[model samples]
Target chain A: MEIRIENLTKAYGDFKAIDNMNLTIADGDLVGLLGPSGCGKSTTLFMLAGLNKPTAGRIFFGEHEVTDIAPEDRGIGLVFQNYALYPHMTVEDNIMFPLINRKVPKNEARDRAYEMAKMVQLEGLMKRKPKALSGGQQQRVAIARALVKKPEVLLLDEPLSNLDAKLRVETREEIRRIQQEVKITTIFVTHDQEEAMSISDKIAVMEKGVLQQYEVPQKMYLNPGNLFVATFLGTPQINVFDAEVHDGKIYCAGNMLRSGCMVPDGSYKGGIRPESFNVTLLPSAPDAIRAEASHVRMTGRELQIRFNLGANEFRLLVHSDMQIGVGTPFYLTTREKQILLFGQDGKTVGKF
Target chain B: MNRKAGNVIANILKYGVLIIGALFTLMPFLWMILSAMKTNAEIRAIPPVFFPSKFSLENFTTAWKAAPFGRYLVNTLIVTVFNTIGVLITTILAAFAFARLNFPGKKVLLTLLLATMMIPSEMLLITNFITMTKLKWIDTYQAMIVPWLASVFYIYLLTQFFAQIPDALYLAAKVDKCRDFKYLIKIMIPINKGPITTITILNVISNWNSFVWPLLVTNSREMRVLSYGLVQFQTEEGSAYELIMAASCILVIPIMIMYLFLRKYIIEGVTQSGIKG
Candidate 1:
């Protein structure tokens, strides 16, 4: 079930959909192909399923090369974005279609289909057509249909994107549970960063038909290789300010914050997570970002204060017990380890 | 109060036009039934009769005996049924290829197939007759049936509908190892029930009403369809208008029943196919 994609590329005339991609997904590993729309994530998934032929490269499932094989012969199961259930078929029939296609005995196929449906927890609605079921239910039917054949690798394209917010969370957790029980190597494609981070063992982040970074979720969050990866992963995104290192000191908002910076003497982008900032009444604290608070709002237990530093705006999370009025001058400090320093080329050159 | 009155007036105006249109359309049918039972004197009157003074079976008996109407019924049924089945087979195959498969000159070939529809069937009558003669298929069922086998219009209609099916479903079928022909029969045909039914009803109707090609190729009384036998209603002296009307009624009733049962499919298929075309 280990998939190895080497030097794969798919081009439409002169425009490449996937460009020289390389990755190795270990057996039983759940990998997420995460990217924005038209970023070639689906293209990579399709190539792995053998639904699309790579322009130049080879794909190996354990030992055999499946680059030129037919899709059915590739031992892969694929779920589409809209679920793609046959409208004419009841849930039972839809789930049983793959088994029947393999020429399994009629009753045996029925038993396996029922078993898979139950695994996906679609027990009572087997007689209803796709239109009769809810979006999450139809998606379950699609999953059952794909897995009834016991494919070595399961590929799902934006499987939970059609569900409501609450349903999406429940369905994703359900998918993770099912994938764990089956222990089949699976690739989940989505544009949502939180969903990818929550369920994936590892993520292969793509951009403009190229692989930007491939790493574990926690490592990718804390240590992004480039500005794009840092910005793409967190909500209320990582705030990046124009900064420079002068005389081995990091300077921002017309003040020196830290000394002995790792990056050389040059302009750089300094990224700080929203939760990494500290706010206080002290305006002259050392190694702090100086700003004037514009607004303060309470969200549950955390107090969020909006502040302006020069022309750019940023927000900080603080303890809700402390009362801070608007238009108050404050100093914000991000721990040195929490700062990400990027070079002129938009890539991290200094970790601290 | 004014709005309610305006609504009532608008409703009346709308239904008044619709009811008048329905009666106008039904008038010919009313006239045909009335004339079939009327005496010749009433039929030849300055104005047509609305209803006969006394209902009579005289015209039905006369029309039934004048020609082999029973034999013509059997012949027309055989030709229409076989023509419809054959045309469905050929057109579905051709349309599936045009819609799903990719090959060299596919666009040009489809454009040419569509272009052939503009050359009215009348222009091909002589050439087809020559072909029938060369094949020595004269006075045979093949001449009548084979000439209408491949229809460009039906192919285009089916292809347009088939193209609307999502490419993802086709890929899913491919992954399930369903071959092209199996996909057509099991997936495409079943899901596109509307268009297929539309094609079947239309094929039966057009073949049932066919006149020219059957006239050119079939001359014997045994080979003539219902339309050809209707010619027997006329002679060099004068045309028998009453018996022809009676025969017309007999000929149309079966097709009417068929349409009544299949009108839902016809409307659905026409509307679905009409979206793109």
Candidate 2:
């Protein structure tokens, strides 16, 4: 089912947790709501699940407005962060609870529960309670319970956050595979960019209860809508510098980096991704700025070098085959397309 | 070797104090049982006999034939069983509402309910009695069972337990389309078996031993509970200490047996609620 969230807002007294957020999730598409803590990603997921009521909004599940509907009637399965399996119940009974609540016959419910357990690879453990299961197994049981009723939309709230690092990766892949097999329109909330980027067909980046950008993962990473999106998406973070765009020339720290700029003459913020910087052995190269390598550390296949350009310090990742040492001077240059300029208001301006 | 000797001495001292305390508490019950087994003359002997000369069931037969003790036991069991069931129902529903539901004036309503706990139940006895009289329910089982069906302390205790359950569980049930009452019966009550068992045992014991309410409400012999029946037996067998002791033993044995069977759950429930007995 496709979901349309129109002008959704949730307010707690004077504070708004979600502010007029509008989004449309395509049918059978696995989207991710990505943001830091308290950014309202979870709140949006709850509203979508109908567990929370919006202050002013209309939510539609394929042409039917369900803003006032209860969670159970909304035809969406929600998996909580802690996988709230009934501790007193066995895996089979936990999966069968929803079916039984719908008044399905006992035999049919048991069959369906067994089928779901088999799908989650829990058939052999059907008689064991939740406390006896490992964290990953408990997570699978929660998913099986949620999907046993075949809800049209599946909502997961930090589903893999409780697992260890290795288990988190494995479980996310399992979740993606299951979501694909079920062909359900799924939206999962996560604070981990890599997890979101790895699984989601589209990622919606949010900040302070407002939607920042909604695009495919690579597009949002490469061509961010604004400064926050640029800095929030990447690991090691994008390097930002205070610069001036004067008379069609870009100057950073009293040094001219580029000319023939098209942006209006004023102050702007310049961002350069760490991997975008090019290193040279030559003392002087055209459009190459001189930088002194201050710190060099090997990180597996890449060398993370901290270099100083004038008084500014920036980190760069390079192939470890290059022999670079501390205090060595090198020429640094980047392609024009790699440079991102943001106006004073933090929105991307004209062209790089 | 010196440290081991010191530890042994400390252990002896700890158990020594505990043994003395246990003996002090058990002395009265021991006396009652011993007195009940003795002949009348042995009970009144100069230095009252610590042990019976020859144990016999003579006093028990006499006590059993004196009045309708069997009838009183039956009445007590009926009132206790019905009262426990009623209290459990009322307490669970009220506690679940207080712990989870959000409604207008919820805080004020809870404050009012809790304020009733501070009013001293003795003050409400006369009012409750008058209400019973007006309902024409005096000298009936309803008078004894209905008035004590809901207890604020139990409700508060269970509300604490219910509140400790994660809200995610409730939301999960809601998403499954389980109604509130079904969730309570299937999930909340089952998950909180220890506390609920404690409440049931406590309620059963309290109902079994209830004296004042039964005394005030019941005027007929057929409607009297065990506690009142024991008092009546005492007055009728005045100066016959052996018969009185025998009747007391009969009343006390059931409670002791019940405690022996359920002591583990009692301790678990008390510690879980963080409340002293």
Candidate 3:
């Protein structure tokens, strides 16, 4: 189902939990609602699932307005963060519960439950209660239960958070594969940027109940609409510095990082990805900005070097062969000529 | 070794105090049984005879003959069984509503109901009696049973248990198209078996042992409960020690049997609910 949310808002007394959010998820498109905790990603997901009433909005599944519909009538499958599998029931019964309520024939419900369980690799564990299963196994049961009814839209709320690191990876892969096989329009809410990037066709980045950007994972990284989106969607974080643009040049820490850019002369926040910095030990390099390495961590094949630019610490990810150490002076330059600039209002300031 | 000895001494003191308390509690039942078999003079004997010289069934026969004890037992069971069913129904519905449903005045209503628990039963007794009389329900089984059918304390207890159920499960049920009442009966009630059993046992006990209301309302012999008979056994002439003791023995038996059977759930329901829920 194609879910279109129009001006959705949820206010808890004076605080707006979801502030006038609008998003369009196309049919059979796997979208990820990515954000930090309390960023209203889950609230958006709940509104889409009809689990929560939007304080102000119209939600549509295809062309039908379903904003006022009950959760059971919404035809959306929701897997909760904690799984929320009925602890008393066996896996088979858990999956079959919705089917039974729909008044499907007994044999057909059982057959469909078997198929969902098998799809999630829980075939032999149908008789086992959720408490007796491992976290990963229980997660599979939750997925199977949610999918058994063959819902048109699948909603998952941090479905992998309860597992250990290894299990999270494995189960997320399984979820991705299952979602593909089912071809249901799946929207999963997650605080993990990497998970969203890894599985989503389009990732909607949100902060403080506002939608910052909605684009493909790589595009969201390459071209963020604001400072928060740029900083939020990368590992080791994007480095930001307060700088001024003048005479077609962007100057930061007494160096012109980018020139021939037609941005107006004004102070702007500068952003550079950790992987974008080029490190050279030679101090008198013109294109490179100099800083003393305060810390160097050799993480397998890559060296994570940390330095101070004034009061803020800056991090750079480079090849381990750079042989950088603490207190070593190195000059830095961006691999790309144009640095990302955000104005005082926090929106992207200029053309690339 | 010194710490081990101290632990042993502490354990001994704990069990020693517990043992003494147990005896103090059990003493009355034992004394009643012993006195029931004795002659009237023997029961009144100073330094009250620990044991009867001759164990006789005479008190049982006399008590059984004088007041139609069998009919009283039957009448009591009828009231108790019906009242228990009624209370369980009312309690489950009220508890579920209090635990899950959102409506105006929920907080204020809950506080008011809790406040009602603090009012002594004695304060409401006269008002209840007047109501029963006005309804022309006095001396009726419905009069005896209906007035005590709903208990705020039991509803409060079940609400605590029901509240402990995750909202996630409730949402999950809603997704599966299960109605609220169906979820309550199939999911909530069965899962909280310990608390439900506790409520049933407690209701049965209160109804079985009810004295003041039954005594106040029922003037006829046919409508009397066992506790009412026990009061009747004591005449205005004097207390009939032998018959009263025998009647007391009969009343305690059923309660003891229920306690023995459901003691684990009772203890679990009473203690675990406050912290666990």
Candidate 4:
């Protein structure tokens, strides 16, 4: 089901934990609520799941007013980060809990629990209690329990945060596969940008309880709406430079950066992804950032050359075969399409 | 000072200390049991007898008949059962409210509950006795049960237990559309069975052995509990040491049985409360 959150707000005494926030999840879409800790991502998810009521505003699930609805009436499945499986019950019983509470027959609940167990790839562990299972298995059982009721929408709040590195990777892939197979209107909340970018069909970036940007994964990465979105959406984070515009050129750190396009007069900052830059002492092409190489390190397939320009250090990725030493000078040219320029207020000024 | 000798001495010291400590702790109970089975002369002997010279069931029979011991036992059972059940039900419900539900006066109410815990039971004894007397509850079961029900300590214990439960569990329950009361009974209560069970055993033991409050309120022989019954059994004509010991054994047996059955829960309850205290 499609979900609409309009001007939702939650306050603790005087502090607005979640300010006037708005978001809309299209039906059957896998959306990721991505943010750092306490940025209102989990709060938003909780409000949507009907766990925490918003102090103000409304929520709609496909034209149904769900703002004031009780959690059980919301028809949503929630997989908590801690799993929340009943410690005293066996896997089968924990998975069967929702169905039993809904007055489903015992035999039917057992059958559905077993079926969900198989779906989560937990076949032979039904008799084991949650405390008896390993972390990964317990997590799978928790997922199975949430899915057993066949909720219209599934909300996962940092479902992989508790797992170790190997398990986190494995479980996140499984979650993505399960979400795709079910095609439920799913919202995954996480602070890890990489996790969101890799799995979500669409991503909503939040900062300080405000919606920074919302778009498809590729659009959010390639055309960030602001500095926060740009910095939060990419790995090997995009490099930002404090620059000035003069005579159709961008001047930064005692260098005239070549750009085929002219930036506005007040555009004081520009962001460039590392992959956009080409490493050379003198580029045959124009519009390149000039700097002295201060450090170099080999990273398996590439050499990361750190350039020193004034007080700032910019990193450039180049082929490992290209030998570069410290104290060497280099010119780094970026593709016109990959540059994301921002103004004084951190909002996007222009992009080609 | 060789290794073998050092290890042997260490083992000896360990067992010696443990055995001595065990005997020291159990001496009183041992004395009571021995005295219960002894004649009055044996009980009053110059030095205490570890074992009785002449074993007799006479003191047990006398103690049983000297007062309505059977009726007191029944009264004690009724009061204990009602008090335990009342404490458990009220504590769980109120703890759940304080732990989870958000209402306008939640903080104020929780502070009040905690504040009530700080008032020692002795402080309320006079006021409670007055209240009971004016209400015409003296010699009534209500006097023994009502004033002691809804204990703030048990509520605080349960609140701590319920609060340890992850918020996510409640959220998951909510998403399943489980009613609030049903969720409390089905999910929250079941998950926290450890602490709740511990609290129940504790409440049972305390209520069963209750003396002061029951003594103050119950004026009739029929309403007396175990501790009060023990006191009332001793007459000024002559102290029946053998009969008192026999009665003490009777009182000790139920608590021993309760502890044996719920030993695991009792230990856990003690340790959990120890950390908090």
Error of 2 at A212 (Å): 0.7
lDDT, candidate 2, A233-290, per-residue tens: 8887988888788989888887777788788888898887889878876855777888
Return the clash pairs for model 2, or none: none
Model 3 misplacement above 4 A: A12-15, A283-286, A298-301, A350-352, B1-3, B54-58, B274-277
- lDDT, candidate 4, at B248: 89
Kindly list the per-residue Cα lDDT of model 3 for residues B116-176, writing each as its tens digit.
9999999899999999999999889999889888899989988988999999889888888
Q: Note the Cα lDDT for every prediction shown.
A: 0.88, 0.90, 0.88, 0.84
For model 4, the superposed segments whose C-alpha errors exceed 4 Å read: A9-22, A265-267, A281-291, A328-331, B1-20, B47-49, B54-58, B65-68, B113-127, B133-135, B275-277
- Taking the tens digit of each residue's C-alpha lDDT, what string does model 4 give over B1-277? 8999999999999999999999998988888888899987877888766799777888888888888878888998999899888998899999999898878998888888788878888989999999998999999999999998888888887888888888777777777667779889988887777788788887887887778899889887777888875775577787878888999888888888978888887787677666321
Say which prediction, candidate 2 or candidate 3, comes out ahead on lDDT. 2
* Best candidate (score: lDDT): 2
Quote the positional error of residue B178 for candidate 1 in Å. Answer: 1.1
Name the 10 consecutive residues with the lowest summed lDDT in model 4 chain A: A258-267
Error of 4 at A195 (Å): 0.7
Q: Write the per-residue lDDT of candidate 2 for residues B14-56, one digit (tens) a residue.
A: 9999999999989998999989898889988997779998989
Report the C-alpha displacement of residue A112, candidate 2, in angstroms. Answer: 1.9
Per-prediction TM-score of chain B? 0.95, 0.91, 0.93, 0.89
True contacts kept of 1: 0.53
DockQ, candidate no. 3: 0.64
